[model samples]
Target: MTLKSPISIYDAQGLAFGILMASLGVTFLKAAALVTGQTAGAAVLLSYLLPLDFGVFFVLISLPFFWLSWVRRSASFTLRTITAVVGISVVSPLLGAFIRFETLPPFLAAILAGACSGVGLIALFRHGASAGGLGILALIVEERTGFRTGWFQMCFDAVIFALALLVLPLDGVLYSCIGAMVLNAIIGWNFRVAQAMPAQQVG
Candidate 1:
């Protein structure tokens, strides 16, 4: 996930951290110069290559998906997603001014990014909201086309990583994959928890 300033060239960590935070993921991929999957990943990758701020790119890339979400999903879903996206674009940049990482390794940063994102995303889900991106499209495809969501995500990740190779070092790509894996694992495990536990127990 990432957050950055539009007025400055800013740091890549903000872009990476921002993309994650917008989706409720924490920011660490940027510290390791890593990228991710989905719309956030694409935005992060673009921020690395372009002069635009991460938030600006995040909003631009999300516009089409927001339209799809409005057409395919409920209006409520789209509204909440818009709120979350705007919140991320605004709030994430402030995190850096408050919290600073003194020293973080690529492996550790990846892990933290996943863990924080997983937890944050769960909270968003509980509130009936989403960050929206490829995720919205993935869900639409899965429901309407009978495609598996997992497979869809995997394919997207594969593409993101492939492109990441051109921009990031091999180790950076590898670490980013690890972060993505951790995020998925946390999501999977928690979904099971959400399903199996009573609503009270889930809390």
Candidate 2:
């Protein structure tokens, strides 16, 4: 597919907003010492297995998926996805650098961060873009199967969480898994509401 730059103000705003939310989600995962699904999840998994920066790892893992979206979807979709991913890649580490909440409880941090991330993700999806990686896959699956996107994401997160147990302590894996579930729940709830609001208004 041919690629082109996004020109509209609405597209730019959507890309910016989506990226901001995704960055917050990544930051929350770091703060809670939790793992997620998609490229970010793979980044966390890689960080445990290798000596690499998670943010760099995130971008690297997302590249293939970005290309896939470019090929399968519109250039506009790819551009927005790339913008969001790059934004998250840059913002995640910066947030990690500037804000380290060591004293906060992991559960609380995970919930707050996951909720913020979910909202950001939904905003991105609603705007016709994605945060990359399994996010694209999740969207495709939801569209095809008519299953809830949140559940699709949760399944992916579970796989990653299981892999995490192989590398991390049992308790850490458990907390990460729980954190992922909470994040998925937040996304699912919001998605359902967004879906329903239109129908209700139409009625």
Candidate 3:
């Protein structure tokens, strides 16, 4: 399906929903002591070891990618991605405070996080934004060559998970891999753009 050129008001709402879901997913992963990949994983890892906030780390990690977004993509795309990153960074901790999971099982947390991240990423992709880090790189690669962003992300995730083995328990690594796969699978299956259509027409 082809989306309109200029972003619609409905898509703006979708952007908000996508950010919210993605933030919630990150929060769940953090609570479960699991890490996915990319900026989110880095932020979670930092928040674990340092006296830093995940929101701050999330936004900080994403800052460097804006340069790539602006140079390879467009100002509008860069701005939108910045907005998405900021929104997720700010909202995640707020959600964490109130949405307490008293006894969230690791498996359940992994599934919930995966589903949220997958659906949220699809929404962001449809609206021409992403959560930054490998997301920005994936989007750019997908735009330049008709490659799938999800697969790109999965490759990056593999590296992240490999490093994660040093810090995370085997069970946590297993669940993280599962969540990562779920996230990329949703994008690969649903967020594909046709060869004839423009990359922006990805709704």
Each model's number of backbone clashes?
13, 0, 0
lDDT of 1 by residue, 78-191 (tens): 665676676666565566446667888989888877777656554444443456787677655655665644456667788889989999999989988888777666655554
Candidate 2: misplaced stretches above 4 Å?
A: 1-5, 192-203
Please rank every candidate by TM-score, starting with the best.
Answer: 3, 2, 1
Could you say which candidate leads in TM-score?
Answer: 3
Q: Number of the top candidate by lDDT?
A: 3
Error of 3 at 109 (Å): 0.7
Per-model TM-score, in order, reads 0.76, 0.85, 0.90
Residue 179, candidate 1: Cα error in Å is: 0.3
**Per-residue lDDT tens digits of candidate 3, residues 1-203?**
22235667976998899999998898889889988878888888778778988889888888889888777766666777888999998988888888887798888888889889889878887776788888988877877787898888888888788888888899999998898888888888778744322454331
Compared with the true structure, the alpha-carbon lDDT of candidate 3 equals 0.81
lDDT of 2: 0.73
lDDT of 2 by residue, 103-191 (tens): 86767766766777787888777766778898877766665566777888897787787778887778767767766777788778777
Which ranges in model 1 have alpha carbons more than 4 Å from their true place?
1-26, 142-151, 192-203
Q: Can you rank all candidates by lDDT, best first?
A: 3, 2, 1
Candidate 1 displacement at residue 133 in angstroms = 0.9
